[model samples]
Every structure is written in structure tokens, then in C-alpha cells.
Target: MLNKTASRSFYLNLWLGLVGLVVGIFAGFAVGISPALLLVAIVAVAGLIWFFASFEQAVIGLLILRSSLDLFSAQQLPAAFAIALNALTILYVLVALLTGKAVKIDKFWWFFALWIIFQSLWVILLPLGGLGMDASFLMSGVRVWLRYFSWLMVYLLVMQLKDNVPPEKIVSMLLLSLVAPISIALLQIFLPSSMLPSLLTSQGKAGSNVSGTLGFPNGLGIFLTMFIALVWWKLSISSKRLPWLLLLGLVSFVFVRTGYFTGLVAVLLLILFINSTKITPVRAIGVVLFCCAFLWMFASTEFGQQRLTEIYDTPLLNPNIDVSRSIILSYGDSNSFNWRIAHWTYLINAWSQFPILGYGLDTSPLLGIRDFNTGSGYAPHNDYIRFLVEQGVVGLTGFLCFLVGQGWYLVHLLRNSQSVNSRRNLCLILIALFVANIVSMLTSNIMDATTFFFYWWTLVAIAGWGNEYWRPNLATKSA
Candidate 1:
């Protein structure tokens, strides 16, 4: 018994989604719309779907562009798309309260609900809307919240629809998401530098292609790390040789061109974590051997060699004499370690200026001080710094409180997990993500934007889902 609006929304979503897919799937920038305008259209369509179809349509939108659109074009939309989906999801969830659906909220949903409410309050109380009725600022808020809403929707959808969704479907969706990014990264690796500029022109940034698929080299590394971890988990659950083989190939290619050591750390941590899972020793050994082959390939490739050279080229990690020391220092030595140290220093120093309320909600870029390194008008590379700069200390504190509370909740779930095997596996994945975030934040500080933000929230929701779904059963078994 669907209402008329719901029914109409579904049909419109289906048709509009198809139109978007057709336009976006091929070339020519969707029949004459400038790349920028096409991106806006994509965002608009995403917003419409999210508003009407709950979070389901948001996922559909993500899938549409992610699977069909060319990487060059697709990257533009995902960041905006994620934000749109998140906002709509949050709005819908809040609205559901009037329908008595509030009773369905377990503890995890409650935490998410609180986060949404807090964000809304911050939006209202602070200068989030900007000084006046600026369409650009308004649109930006819409985009930011969309990602948060998307993750919420994903979590709610997964938890509620867990029974309805086949394992294969879940696996397929995730696999597809990673596949597009991996393919693009591989292209960057194998393709000539002369050819890269055209593909990367979407970023419209000067100098160097900004690592398509994940939007940067480190970002791509994160994607690879997550996929490799996922593939390991899948292998533990099922013995599908093809997925393992394919994932191994993708993972190897990602690391070779990443030029960042984070992937190596992620892979190492994932392997250790998987070993702790109940995966068979035989399978684990096979994975290790497979990874080694990929490592060897990484070392052999031209791109791999270049990336490898960069690893040793720096004196930051290696105090030993490295030829690239002068070059890195010229680029800004103190700011080079992802600029976390330098950026954090600046943010801390600047906090007293607006300590309590901060610079107003999402006003870091406005301050002009945080954009020191790239000079591209970006948020602080670290979420902590960005949160403080944008939301101020008060807003940042609220967010931290929420995160810490969620972690405490996870502890209870971990202790009470029904199946030790699944629980352990879940723990491993969560830990890997946590560690990855630590590395990203400590070094680079790039988590608050785009698909990376989407990844962070999705992982959180997944952790919450696993906790709620498995805890009671695990507790009973332990007892």
C-alpha cells in the first residue's frame, strides 16, 4: 500500500534515473551541456531522488554514475552526489518520526539520529547559510549534507533490508563501486602522462592529474585498501576463486601507482586482521602468496618503480640522505607530511579567534588562512582541524562526543557478538578503516570531502549495523 506521492516518486525516479544514465553513460558531456553544468544537473537529479525516494534513490544515483559514466566525468558528481544523498536521507529519517516509525530505532539508529539533529542545529545557529542568500553557499550545504544523508540511508537500508538483500547483491554493489575506481587508477598507472591531462581536465586544477577514481593518489590507495580488506572478508565467507583473483589484480595495480606508502600499511594491517578472523590457514596462505605476486608486479612496473622511488626520495620517513630532500623542502617541508602538523598548528593558533562558536559553521575557507598549502581554497586536510575551523570548538566538541559515544557502543557490541567468527571479521574491517583514517588524518587530512567522507560514514554505519544485528546472538552464545 504505497501512497500516490511515493508511487509517483518511484516512477519518476526510474525514468529520470534512466535519462541520467543514458546521458552520463557515454561521451560528449551529455549532448552539449558544459561539463560544469552537467555536473550540476547530476547533483540536481541526485537531490530530487534523495528528497522523494528516501535514501534508496540516492544509492541508485551513486550506482548510475559510478557504473556507467566515464571516470573523468564521474569524479565530479560523486562528491556532490554523496552530500545530496546524505542530506535527503537525514531529512527523511527525521520526518519518519511523525509516522510512529520512531519506535523502530534501535540504539545505533538513535546515535545517527542525534548526529543529524546536531548538524541541523549547527546549521541553524551558525552562519552556515552564509552572510546572505548566496545560492552557491546554499548549494554547498546541500552537497555536504547529501553525503551524510547517503551514509545514514545506506545504514538504515542495510539494517532494515538485511533480510531482503541477498549476500550476492550486497557483494555486487560494493564490488562494482570499487571496480570503477580501480579501473581508472589502473589507467592512470599504465596510460601515458601526455594522455592523463585530458582525462584529468575535469578537476580543472592546474598541474598534475589528481588521481582519478578516488580523486587523489592517497584516496585511490584508501579505496584499494578497503577493497582488499573486503575481498579478504569475502574469501573467508565463501571460496570464490574469481573474485579473489580479480581483487588481487586490482589491489596490486592500485599500490603500484599510488606512490603513497599508506596502501602498503593498509594491506599489511588487513592481512594481519584477516589472519585474526576465522579464515582458514590454507586460504590465508594462498592470499599471502597472491599478494606477494602482486607486490612483485608492483615492483616491476615502470609506474611502480617511480612510486617506489618517491617512497625513499623523502627524508621525512627516512632520515638517511635522500636526494629528494631539497625538492620536498622546496615544496614546504614542515607541511609535506600531509601538512597535518603545519595545518594543525595554524588551526590551533587560529582557534582562539573564534574558540567557542568557531568561525561559524563551514567558514574555514572563508577565513583564508587554512588554504595555505595548495592555495586552492580547501578545508584543512584533517577533519579535526576542518571541524574546528568550520564549526568552531563547540560544534567540533559535539561531533567528537558523538563519535566517542559510538565507539563505546561498539565495545558493548563486540563483547556481545553472537558469532565469534563474524564478529572477529567485522572487528578486523573496522580496525583497518580506523587505522587508515588515522594515517590519512595524521599525514594528509583529506577525509571531510567527497567520496572519502562517504566511505567514512558508510564504514561507521556498517559497524553499527554489525553491532546491532550480531550482538544479542553473540552474547547468548558466550553465556
Candidate 2:
């Protein structure tokens, strides 16, 4: 099944990476000036080769990569290098199958692959035939497209590797991988803002925002939400709860610092859902009271003050009324919101032209709309609006299926879960995160946020590890 394209690209990156490593070493040797970085490169190349030799290493190595490196940071990496990481991984999967690696991939994932290919082509070809994508746009979108595949690869890799490795070991390594991101975020807190690079401290003054290594507070907030859920699970299973509990508290403060309230809301929801099996009318009332107190506390934060004001200005937007240019929109126009209402309104009206089919994948932003004052183009802040306007109804439906389908599987697993104590913890955290992420997607650009989805898919892959209820339907009806 190896096509000519796949075969050619299969070993190309590995060979190239090795050659580059050799050339650099010789260049350093000939000059009699090998630096510490050259040594690091040598070790990294060795690690890359080791990853190539073992799927288990590749999966764990990728965890290290996602957590440690800034995936989209332009200053830290060449665009080609970042693409190569995932590109070579996909090629590795092809190599694995060709070499007869024995593993059973779930059928749902196979179908998901087909959808991604179809959608990618739709975007690529449409732009080629019409607007003719420039190099920057083309490259940016390719990275986005590759991430969809990386999600599948991580899932399949975990599913295959789980048979030999304890899920705890894998999860533990992943949690340990958080050291870099946490350290970087912590540096922004204690160190002076001027001490850090501007890219690392996107919030200007470091104390104002905790962008972390991910380089954006909003996306970092979403990523930490996952960490919070998982850390909660770790707290449940660990004999040494002090460490996990401390990590939980520190991470929560950083999440709050990010000023991305949507993530905060999601984490709250996750906590509530973890109590779903025990919920009663009295508990429900207590939940409402607790939420009110939490929101009140949140409104005291700088970002929360802005958000609370916006909500207060509007109270509740009446569906029957049109307030596109009303007082609520006016309040949001001046701040970090930057008039999202006007942007969404304009985009929706434009989308009416091709409501069924959409403009094309990743083409919604090409509509050439801009803010008058800033004269800067705004990304579709809302993903649902972006999908509808760009990929249309069909694209939106397909996306909803991907998100909803995962939730459906998680819910089913929990409902029919076996008596394995460890498995219950995994189910609760995973399901909490799945539902929480969807809620966060409404305000921010979750689809384009590489760091968030990279970790999101990894979490999904490992969530079912070592669990009996996670088998494919063909294998058995239930655990």
C-alpha cells in the first residue's frame, strides 16, 4: 500500500536529518570550534534516530517536544524544522505499517483520516483555483493541516504501545514533561519582564500575563486546563498527594493569570461533572452557590473586570433583537475584545452567499475584512463562525462530529466502565476535559491553536490506556 510519494518521503527526512548532523559536526571540527549547542544537536539527532527505531520512544519523545518547545514560536525555530517533526512522524507510521508492525487501529480513526484528507484537499484546491494562496498563507495552513494528522498518529501510537507499557508510566512521563512549560511560566512571574525575550513574554510586562512557553496566554490557559484535570486525577491515585496538590494550586493561579475566563469556566464544569454520579437537588443548589462565589472572586482579577463589565453591559442578549451596534458591542469595542461582535456579524452575513458549501477550508480569513481604526485583519475569533463561513455547513457538521463523537465514546466508556479503580480516574478526567474544551472553543481560535490541540489529542490518546473498556467493537461488545 506504500505509494511512490510515501516511499520516497519515507526515509528522506531521516537520511536528510542524519546528513545535516554530520555536515554540522565536520564544519565545527574543521573550524576547531565546536560549541555546547553542537553537542546538544548531536544528542538530539541520536534521540531522533532512537525514536525512529521505537514507536514507544517516538510517542514519549513527542510528549517532551510538545511540552518543552514552542511549537509556533517564529524566533526559536525554522518553519521547516517544526513541520519536519510531525511530517517525519507520519512517515514513520507509514514505515511501521510497511514493516508489518502488528497493531489494530480503531475503525473510527480511519474514517477520521479520510475526512481530514478530503477537507485538506478541499481547502488547497479551492485556493489554488481561486485566490491563489501566497507562500505565507500556504505554509501557515499546511502546519494546521498536519496537526490534524498528528492527532491521529499520537492516538494510534499510544494504542499500540499500551500493551507493553504501564499507562501510569506513560502518564507520569507526560506529567513530568510539564516541567519546562511550568518553569518558563514561573520565570515570567518572579523574574523582571525586561529579563525575558519579548516573544517569551508576549504580555509585555511578565507579571501582567503568564504566556508560558506556549507564547500566548489564551492558548496557554487552555493547555493548563488539561493539566489541571489530569493533575486532579494524579492527586486521586498518588500516595504522595502533597506534590500533586501543590502542582494543582500553582497551575490554577497561572491559569487565572492567563486571563482566559473561558478556560476557567471549563475547569469549573469539569469539577461539576466529576460529581455527576452523586449529584442531588441539594448538591445542585450548592453548585449554583459555589459558582456564584467563584465568579465573584474571578471578577476581581484585571481581565475578569473587563469580562464582567461586558456581561453586565448586556445582561442577556435577546435572540429576537438585533444589537449589532448596541451598548454591549460598544463596550467591547475599546478593549482586548476589539469589536468581535461586528466582526462575527460581518462574517456571518458574508457567509450567507455560500451557506451550504462555504468559501473553502482556511479561506474564511481571505475575505479581506479589516478593522477601520487598527487597519488590521482579525482572525475569526469564533471557530464555529469560521467553519461556517469558510467550510460552510458541511465542514461545520464534520467538525462537530469529531468533537461530539469523542465525547460520545468517553461517555459510553464511563457508563459501562469496569471495576478497575485506576480506569475510573482516567475516565473522569478525560471526559471532564473533552466537554470542557468544547466550551472553551466558542470564544477563542481552538482549531488554529497548535499547542492546545497537540496536547488535547495526546490526552485523548492516553486517556484510554490500560483500560479494558477501550477495545474496538469488533473485538468485544464491552469490557
Candidate 3:
């Protein structure tokens, strides 16, 4: 594919860069040149070369998508988006045609399929039709599909890896990802907005504790809960020198400081449940002490003190302004809880109207009520309510299959699983993470698509795949 001229240009550029870097380094001694300048130049050249290499790599990834992903454009999405669904469809067809083996539809698949059918049917039957939802086709529809596309890729990757990868490897990846979000959260909480120009530019807002790569405080809280669960799971069974205790304490501190009530509750439950499994009174006291210390650390900080004082004075302290809107307009205060309540009320009303199919897929409960400023009536604060609104009863039922199935599955796995320390620990970890995600979703509606959904699906895939560890030869027999 490479032309001789282009190949020559590439090699020439590479050699020129190498030679230039060597000259710049050597010249620093004789010409009194700054090594920092030489280093910067080399870095710049290396970065340019790497950018070219990434282009080639991205092209290969895109090619595997069979033209679904546009690699040549500057505004391109990841190839994984296209590759995921293609892989699933190919798997299904191959199983059907070549082997004459019909893909046995499980209850989970039935739920999902029914939900999709209901969504399609509703779209067709609506008086205004699908055109109503496609009003902001570019922004809303495109964004929703892109997120689902991302979810598809993540689902495929985890499912494929289910058989081969060890639980520890998955746990490790989860632990490593925690660093990025935690680091970003810490920066936002501690650093001035003007300090990180790049992150500020990307995020569109700064100086708020909740503003991070995830774009919301609640998202970050959810992430923290999941990450700590991973750590807790790893620590419970391993004899290795893991700093899980320290991690638990640190994350708990961040969780409380985040002001995300659900996250705090999830973490507390995780600690209590895990420790109570063995029923050590000493550990129980330690947990209580740790909770107090965590509370104390928050109360010591100015923000923490004010928040605590406000909570303490909630009943007595009059808001003196409308509390039913997302943006609270009280003097010296801003609260969105009232708006969530109103939106939730509106969502409940919407559900009552379309009890069976709801208001079509991707339609938020607050879909019709436009925001005065941005006109974006998208995404209620609740995931379960949002699912009911968009997918209607069918969607809710399908999701319930996943929710209730996972719960039953976790209990079944935990009870019947081999009584090995590592396996038991892994089971508990899964349970904690599952509980944390469900709890987090109560306050934030993120399961549809986003990093939250990706992580949730990854955990589910891991559960399905990892279950075989406890039931050896099960897949072979099922196949």
C-alpha cells in the first residue's frame, strides 16, 4: 500500500529526527546549549512521529470494523464502537448457518429483545411518530447512539475475555483506573480552577468539587464506590501485602467529601457487610472508629464544616427561595434537589400516560419540559424512572431481569461456589460492586450509556464468564 516516495519520506524523516536529537544532545556540551531545549525538541519530534504511528494503528482498528468507523476523518470515534455489534451479529449468524445451531434464547435475551421490540412498536404507533424524538437528531439521537455504541464495544471486549482472563487481572485493571478519576477529583477539590487550563477548557466549568473528567460529582462518587469494592474484594482473601485498608480509609474520606449521599451509604454498607461476614466485634469497632475519623476529617475542612452545619440546620434553616428547581436560587446557596423532585414527579406522570411502552426509547421522563436556558429536557436524576419513561413497561421489565437475575445469580454463586478463599473473596467483591452500582443509580441515571454503563456491563460480563471458575466443564456441557 505504501508508495516508494512516501516510504522514502517516512524513513528520511525518522533518520533526520534521530540524527537531530543526537546533534542537539552533543552540541549542548560545546555550544552551551540547554539540555532542556534539546530534550523538548526531541520530545516534540517524537510526539509527531507517534501521532503518525497512531494514525496507522487507528486505521487498522477501523478496517476491522468493515467501514463502520470513519478513520480518515479528524472528528472520528473509536473503532471499538463499530466492531462490537458487528462481532455479536457475526457470532449469531455463524452459529446459525454453518452449524445449523439456533442461538438458544435465554430469559435475559428475551427481556432485552422484548424491550427493543416495544421501543420500535411505540415509535411506529405514536401519533407524531419517531419524528417527534428526532427533533434534535444531531445532538440527542447521535449522542445516545454513540454512547450505546461505546457500550456495545465494552460488552464485546469483556465477554470475549471472560473465559481466559483471571479475576485478579480484572481487579487490577479496575484498581488502576481508580487512580485517574481520583487524581482528577483531588485536583478539582484542592487546586484552583485557573491552575489546570487544559482540564478546565475540556470540562467547561472549574472550581467545583464535582467537576472532573466524568463531568459530574455523582458520577465520580459512583466510580469511587466501584473502585473501593474492587480493592475490598482483593484484600479479603489475598495473603499478599495489599494496602487495601489504607485505600478503604482514603476513598471513604473522598466519598464523604463528595457530598454524594448514595455513595456514602454504599461504602458504609460494603464495609459493614464484608466485616460482618466473619462477625468480629473488634473489626466492627474499628469500622465505627474509621467512620468517625472520616466524618471528623470532613468536619475539619471549611467546606466540610459548612456542609455539615447546613445538614444539621436543614429543618430550621429556611431556604427562602424556590426549592423545586434544579438550580436553587436561594441567597448564598445553590441546590438542585427540589428540581429533581419536580422532575421525578413529572416523570411519574409521563409513565402513567404510556404505561405499557412508555414514551419510546431514549425519551427522558422530562422529555417534553424544555430547560429555559438550553432547552435540553434530557436525563432525569433517576435511572429506574428514566428506564420506565423511555422503554416503558417493557424496558423496565427487561432491566428488572438484569437487576433481579444478577441478584439471584450472585446469591447462587456465593452459596454454591467452591469454598476456596480466593473464589469466595471474588464473589463478595462482585456482590459489593453490584450493590454499589445499584445504589449509585438510585440518585443518578447513568445505566443507559456512559462510563457508568460500560463499567456495569463489564462487571456483568465478568460475573457470567467468571462463574465458570466455580462450575468447571459447565460451558462445554451447555455448548
lDDT of each structure? Answer: 0.55, 0.66, 0.55
Return the number of clashes found in candidate 2: 0
Tens-digit per-residue lDDT, 1-479, candidate 1:
46855765665566556766775664356547567776766766666655555544345345435432334445565554445555645645544543334423357777887787776654564344433223345546555555466666656644543433333344446666765666665566566657766655453222322355555666666656666766665554554558666776666666655655555665666666556545677767876786687678667755556556655435556677343443444345432442334445556667767676665445555543444576655466567777776667677898688667766766665565435544555555666566555556544545453455454444444554444344333222110
Predictions ranked by TM-score, top down?
2, 1, 3
Whole-structure CA lDDT of model 1: 0.55
Error of 2 at 221 (Å): 0.5
Clashing pairs in 3: 324-339, 325-339
For each candidate in turn, the TM-score is 0.66, 0.79, 0.66
**Model 2 pairs whose backbones collide:** none
Clashes per model (N, Cα, C within 3 A): 19, 0, 2
For model 2, the run of ten residues with the poorest summed lDDT: 470-479
Candidate 2, lDDT over the whole model: 0.66
Per lDDT, the best of the predicted structures is 2
Which model scores highest in TM-score? 2
Off by over 4 Å in 1: 1-76, 79-104, 128-143, 193-210, 277-335, 338-340, 365-375, 418-424, 453-479
